[model samples]
Target: MADETDEPDSAAHPFTRLTPDLVMDATESVGFQCDARILELNSYENRVYQIGIEDDEPVIGKFYRPERWTESQILEEHTYTQLLADSDISAVPPLIIDGSTLHEFDGYRFSLSPRRGGRAPAVDDLNTLEVLGSHIGRIHAVAGDGGFTYRPLFGLQEFGLDARDAVVAAGYIPAELMPAFDSLYDGILADLAALFERVSVNTLRLHGDCHMGNVLWRDDLPHFVDFDDARSGPAIQDLWMMLSGEREQQQNQMMHILRGYRQFNHFNLAELQLIEGMRALRMIHHVAWIARRWDDPAFPRAFPFFDSERFWSEHLLSLKEQWARLSEPAIEIYD
Candidate 1:
């Protein structure tokens, strides 16, 4: 595992500040006996623990990465919770501690919230897709109406994944792996500029990172998590996230979301068909992110291409596919 503490403020994003032993002791101090083991859940910048009590319900304990210096994850959670509630969108509620607020443990900030109920659905799962679409509709409604209003905090990376850092992250790959990473990374950057010029939607509070894996299907209910990547700007910015893992056949996921989203939202006629181009740009971002998080536990795994030739050829194929649809397009009509 690459050092999760490799960022600038190494002390802040400590992986073990709130250890399982510490959690057991804390709960015990509060008169609850945590009987079950604390299992580790993956996250790129934070630590999540699945804690189960004998007679009570299972819960999740989240330790915000100490390295979260730029953005206030806690404040973002606090605000997004209330905003989602006002929008009637259910989300992970912030845990309260000592009647004040949930934050780093003493000097150590951490929080405990309800664990997601069931299994994480595959990207193309229909039911989960509907859940994602509906919830996103609600979010768009809120954001478009000026309901979700707050600025995000940034570390060194201006956004959760900086466009320029895309290249720097490629440095992680060994020299032997250099050519392959370069070919994929360069194509993605080009795709970024192309998509930025093509798509349009309301500049609302987007989920920022919206791929299928970011959600869970618990007892048939779909739940979304992780706001560390949140940012402002074009709503279609989320198109990248929604299509992140659906590379094999992203159309199904895109269409499934369109089916549900169109019910509550409207785009200029041209904007609707541009979904393909928008999603193509999203794929580029996803691929670059995959390269960046090569050692990141929470991000997607590496592409399965055999070599640089295959990867570049794949990018060319996707570019051609995207351009084919770009000719007759949906232009953005912002609110």
Candidate 2:
């Protein structure tokens, strides 16, 4: 048996019933025989496992968080990824069984996918980024075929305004830091609203969270995974997170990425203005996400610094910096 402290409480968490036997049974229920070995993967919002199959390669089992997404919404994600795979874009989609990609066992909705192996794409290499950019542009080209019927849009209302409200309402900020937090957050939100209004761009289904962790590189190319965060948003939402380092470095990075991006789809120069605005929105949303998930045992273990005076102090400092960045001109991307 696993140590009590090391595992999330079954009663406190939905995964209480998710045992090794249950996982094997779930995988076998679809047809394959399990080898009875289950390896828990690192995932917070949902439980994931790599289960060995009898006489076959291992498969990935992803159990969805209860009530987080409706059946149709999950299907939308599956459909999009499957479309990408069929279109020859390097993406992983769930395996289809009995004409369905999604299946449920023991009251938990789950999906199985053949595991693809790769390391993180070299984000700083201009050549590698150019390759990844072309793939993303192709992904977006397919995404533009239609809008999501269920997934939400990435924008100010949810990521910015609601996030700011949730933070203040949670009372996580130190009493001494409340004024600074509020004042800085308010200024950021106001500027965010103005920036969104100033720069109007078309929206398309996006990878949503295109960070390095979600990408795997093999054969000198990129393979995208975890479209769980897929939603409708400006193209920059997909491009911005891949950038790192100082302003000049990010500018060069964007230039290379766009070089590949523009080949498949039109690149809007005006949307460049929203990069810092998007950053600000993400900062606010991150705090709120942590606060909302605080009740989950994994959250405290992962973010022990949360709700502390020092944490709020540093957060406030970051917000102040973001406020300044929000005021400055957006990162320039020369063609």
Backbone clashes in each candidate structure, one number apiece?
A: 14, 0
Please write out the lDDT profile of model 2 over residues 17-114, one tens digit for every residue: 78888988889899999988889988988889999988899999999988889999999999999999999998999999999999999899999998
Q: In angstroms, give how far residue 39 of model 2 lies from its true place.
A: 1.4
After superposition, candidate 1 runs with Cα above 4 Å error:
1-13, 16-18, 25-33, 69-73, 99-101, 121-131, 145-161, 173-191, 218-220, 237-256, 268-335
TM-score of each: 0.66, 0.94
Model 2: number of backbone collisions: 0
Q: Say which candidate scores most in TM-score.
A: 2
True-structure lDDT of candidate 2: 0.87
RMSD each, Å: 6.4, 3.7
- Pairs that clash in candidate 2: none
lDDT of 2 at 128: 89
